[model samples]
Target: MSGIFLKQADFFETNGILFETGGFFLKQAEFFLKQAEFFMKQSDFSEESIVKK
Candidate 1:
């Protein structure tokens, strides 16, 4: 029946949206982690420079 097909299509669409949102969050988290690592290294270098001076 047409109604059954529509329901199945809707279910698939919902799943697609959830997957896309999850992927976006994962990417954002990875980006923030990289930024944190870079900042940490920078802080360490600055501290070493001060100590040397």
Candidate 2:
């Protein structure tokens, strides 16, 4: 009985760790995507200014 409970607890702990790691990676991906979008917009603006000139 105690052994089964211990196993269940261990499984939950591992799953929790995996979830936390996934969340961290997701945040990093979002940050990078935002940075890429910002750079793309900046480039487009520069291109427009050059064209106008």
Candidate 3:
């Protein structure tokens, strides 16, 4: 607490926020990837159906 150049408490708080933000972005990326995969599967199914008919 004392003699810390940058204030240890503030450093930890900022670090925690950074981690939370990183996690949020990662979840967003994962959600978008899943969405894209779903669309890809749907299009593939549609193509197969069209070819069958």
Displacement of the residue 48 alpha carbon in candidate 1, Å: 0.4
Off by over 4 Å in 3: 1-20
List TM-scores for all candidates, in order. 0.61, 0.61, 0.61
Please give the range of 10 consecutive residues that has the lowest summed lDDT in model 1: 1-10
Scored by Cα lDDT, where does model 3 land?
0.57
- Check candidate 2 and list the clashing pairs: none
Model 2: which ten-residue window has the lowest total lDDT?
1-10
Candidate 1 deviates by what RMSD? Answer: 17.3
Please give the CA lDDT of all the candidate structures: 0.59, 0.59, 0.57
- State, as a TM-score between 0 and 1, how close model 3 is to the true structure: 0.61
Q: What is the lDDT of residue 37 in candidate 1?
A: 64
Question: What would the per-residue lDDT of candidate 2 be over residues 1-53, giving only the tens digit for each residue?
Answer: 23444444455556556787755555555555555566667778888999999
Which is superior by lDDT, 1 or 3?
1
Q: Per-residue lDDT tens digits of candidate 1, residues 3-42?
A: 4444444555565567877565555555555555666677
lDDT of 3 by residue, 3-48 (tens): 2422433444455567876565555555555555666677788889
